[model samples]
Target: MQIAIDGPAGAGKSTIAKMIAADYGIIYLDTGAMYRCIAHRVLLQGDDFSDTEKIIKLAQEAEIRFEGEKVFCNGEDVTESIRTPLVSLHTSDVACIKEVRELLVAQQKKIAGDQSVIMDGRDIGSVVLPEAEYKFFLDADVTERAIRRKKELDAKGIEKELASIKQEIQQRDDNDRNRVEGPLVQVEDAIVVDTTGKSIDEVCAAIKKYIDEVRA
Candidate 1:
């Protein structure tokens, strides 16, 4: 009963995933947060994102855990820590490393193997959960995505310019799509949902209806 949701940043992957998982009484795994946990670890040590060995070593020893909506790394709660803009910037660097992806992907597979899980990430459908019973690709206009991100940060009282946020998201898209290890891609069988002007509930309903119709 595993479900995979893949998408670029700010496409409402996490929010919608959590909703669907809750509706189905399944575990929702935020796979991007796993990579961000490793990035946060490296940033805590230094700003050398280019050091592949250091990043891989940090990843090798990392213990990422998910308890409901919170993320824990090495027994420490990093739910809020890993969501920082800084960690978001460096997450791609860690995710690009071959060894790091293998380690995290194995953990992701193991988690799914243990239960019926709903996982979301850039590469989940393509790599981590290729055999998932359901796969969805959510996408939206880049500007719309950036606006969503700005609202999130603003709600958190973290100020950031919209233009800069848009640029940062663009960079993330490029990196995610171009990365060699586990690139962001829409699998052929994945149901594509354009969320450019849709509300979260709208998208969720659309997905549920699609899945339910097929199952029926």
Candidate 2:
């Protein structure tokens, strides 16, 4: 059984997907991190982010491996490196490219094939795993999602202005929604979950309820 959770930035899809995967005793896949891993490599090489060809080469040539929650790129541990604010900002540009999406989406599908996995990303429901046994579209308003991002960064000691974070989030949304291939959109049968005012447990319960209904 595969579950695809689609959401914009900071909509809690990653957190919820990890939790749901743990509860259901399945592997969890974070497709966004795959792009971030490539971005981290590009940045490490001091390559320009807007150079789509370089980015695609880096993505295709780089060795990205996920061991449980840790991510390794090019045999180097980058689980923590890719989560930086710099990587977050640059990855959006890399991810919006058609070639990058095609390469990574193919790899994502291969990783989740024949596994009981819970995957989360902007295009999971619409592209990466459209035939997943269960699917969800998670969303929250901009301001609310920005606040959540601020809190997360603060916890990591990454000082960032809320306004700047909000602006970056908007830019990411625009880039993802307007991308030529596999743009972010809800799958037809996915249940939309507004996560603005919901607790983690509540969201998990709602998803569990949906899973139960689907399996019934």
Among these predictions, the greatest lDDT belongs to 1
Pairs that collide, model 1 = none
Give each model a TM-score.
Answer: 0.98, 0.96
Residue lDDT tens for model 1, 1-216: 888999999999999999999998999999999999999999998889888999999999998888888888999999988988899988998999999999999999998996999999998988999988899999999999999999988998899999999999999999999999999999999999999999999999999998788778
Regions more than 4 Å wrong, model 1:
none
lDDT of 2 by residue, 1-216 (tens): 999999889899999999999998999988999999888888888958868788888888978888988988888888888898888888878888888899999988998988889999888988998899898999999999999999989998999999999999998888878887778898889999999999999999999998988788
Query: Model 1 Cα RMSD, Å?
Result: 0.8
